[model samples]
Target: MSAVLELVEFDAEGFMNDAKAWTPEIGEAIAATLGITLTNRHWVVINFARKEFTEKGEAPSLRRITKTTDVDTKEIYQLFPGGPAKVAAKIAGLSKPTGCI
Candidate 1:
């Protein structure tokens, strides 16, 4: 785990315990664990996920992301690799997205 991870609390699946406690630094640290380096494009998705979480009180699904953001399904898969919505939500410091299996 990174130093930032050590300072925060997460669930067994590694989602942050509190979205309110999330910071950009912490998001980067979480992404590091998944071997992801946040790019501007990645931030687009992350920021959108955070916004969705704030608005809906839950992380958005992949379909929702693709439908709402400029990013498409293929690019989201390319960017996030293993389960776009789930990974993006984790990095965004939100709970595991509903309906993600």
Candidate 2:
């Protein structure tokens, strides 16, 4: 059976305060709020961001994402349009990037 996750409230930057509350459905909702449609390509980045956060206890940096993931910086920027790391991370249900304001 699939788990049902409710729509969560996001912080000002659109990040969910509780990572455990996140789900694929919630990710889609968050993406919609940012005027984004979650494509397969977008999922690659989102999944990567979640993995990084799980292993590192912080959001993944764009640099690390590009270097480690199959996608490059150009593709990621095009996928997310504006604020790729910040936006994608938020949609991935992670906190704001450490250095972002």
The candidate maximizing TM-score is 1
Using Cα atoms with residue i matched to residue i, what is each candidate's TM-score against the true structure?
A: 0.95, 0.87
CA RMSD of each candidate after superposition:
1.2, 3.8
Worst 10 residues of 2 by lDDT: 1-10
In model 2, what lDDT does residue 65 have? 85
As a TM-score, model 1 comes out at 0.95
lDDT of 2 by residue, 1-101 (tens): 11233447667755789887788988887787678899999998999899889998888888888988998988999889888888888888899878555
Error of 2 at 34 (Å): 1.2
lDDT of 2 at 50: 94
| Strongest candidate by lDDT | 1
Report the error of model 2 at residue 37, Å: 1.0
For model 2, the superposed segments whose C-alpha errors exceed 4 Å read: 1-7, 99-101
Clashing pairs in 2: none
